[model samples]
Target: MLLLIVMVNSCYVPSNLRTVVFSSVNNNVCKRLDGDIVLYAIFVDSKFTNPWSKYDIETTLDSIRVATEWIEQKALEDSVDVHIQVAYHKTLQGRVPIKNDFSKKTLSGTLYKKPLWSGVRDIYKWADKIAKEAGLSMPRDTSPITNIKNDLKNRERLIARLRDHYQTDHVALMYFINNYYSDEISATFDISNDNNVEFSIVSFKNPSVIAHEFLHLFGAYDLYLTQYDVKKRDKKKKDKLMEMFPNEVMAFAHRNLSSLNISDFTKYLIGWKKEMPVEYQRLLLKKGYFTAKY
Candidate 1:
């Protein structure tokens, strides 16, 4: 009976540890104000001959390291501890079967593919598979991944698989490339409440762009809008908002990190600051940009 009791208690200890660890990890991304966070990064290598030489890859990784270190320093100033671990999956190639790469150069001619979500889903699925093959562990919680749609069903499922394998709620899937792809951009997708960041090879090396996209995973929005884009129905409103946040990180990401800071409104959006400023709220409401929930 004594041995039995000890064994049962030992099993319970790990379960309790998991609960505490996962709760802390989820809170770090979902509603972080302070505390340690672990960011999982997976680098996707391109199979095709690419523009990045050995030196470029080395320099890019160096820049990414600098950006992450900067983030840790900034978080420390706000009493938050951040630790980012980058895993390079060189064995995994950035190619989805039966689909062309989602770039203007590839898809502009006759290589265009329909239902773009399918290709995107393939990328996430491939990442999950490669991570498993590499024997990576992830947090196993499906409940936190909310707001998944039919179009995002595969991505949502992959998120669960990755979390279970990683054993942590905070995970980032980065698709790195070496080719001269069109539109060197960094983006983040919020699926089922889980956020993932993706960037091209060039964007990965840019600290400002990396920081801007990183904040998006935490629910920050872009404050800047180009007036020339006819698709923007609320161009005037966005322009007004940009004026309100002249030096905000999301809006001025093309600039150096030293010249920009995360605005209070962005802080509120990411749950860093508790309350949204009244003046900002009034301006948003007057401009028809304010909604009941962020």
Candidate 2:
């Protein structure tokens, strides 16, 4: 079981916050890779260092357009209907510093030690901060995530508002941070609730990276070797997966989108395919996940 500790008036490490895993992809708001997906982009910039410019925002929008078009094209090739629509909400200034590559401690201390739940909490906390700063009244949801049933009623209400505003059920909250010089890792947070809380914090405006993170919001796992893959067997599997699909978007995400294509494995993950082949079962998630209709 995942232990979620909510500390008050302090930045202390949760004593035992390890043993976290990716929520079932279908549990994310961006459930399927089909139909319409509204990318609710929230642009944030650090006041101390990098700041957002009109040109930067425009370029990032252009990149998002290109990335979405690429994803749509890939979906078409797989005979899946997918239409991406981006909705830029607002540029938040003066308060934006969502930085944490947890090493020995967590955002409060270490990434490795805290893992998914801590990261998820950070995301929620950041979103709450953004909402509060925007003068939106929030209901109390101070409880930590304890079960598959989300305790964060504030998040639910916020998401409902966004959905109603956009007139779409599928909304992927994207936070684009202006931290290009810091070498910060862009992140697609684990699914909090299939109906609402699904988001990615992107640092760069690269089309491929943007598209890769978007796909992750749906279901695609990282095909390339990441620091998260600490197990030797997992590393070997990732290496093999990368070798199998060199130009796969989930594999070489840093590469240009023009050079990359979504693989069958990725297709399955994103719901473009009905089923993942048994041959690649090792790479697919555990049992009870193959059955899906989100």
**lDDT of all the models against the reference?**
0.48, 0.63
Q: Give per-residue lDDT, candidate 1, residue 181.
A: 43
Model 1 lDDT per residue over 57-76, tens place: 67766766766677677666
The reply for model 2, stretches above 4 Å from the true place, is 1-25, 91-120, 132-155, 192-196, 285-294
Question: How much does candidate 2 score in TM-score?
Answer: 0.73
Which prediction has the highest lDDT against the true structure? 2
Candidate 2 residue-wise lDDT at 71:
88
Evaluate residue 241 in candidate 2 and report its C-alpha lDDT on the 0 to 100 scale: 94
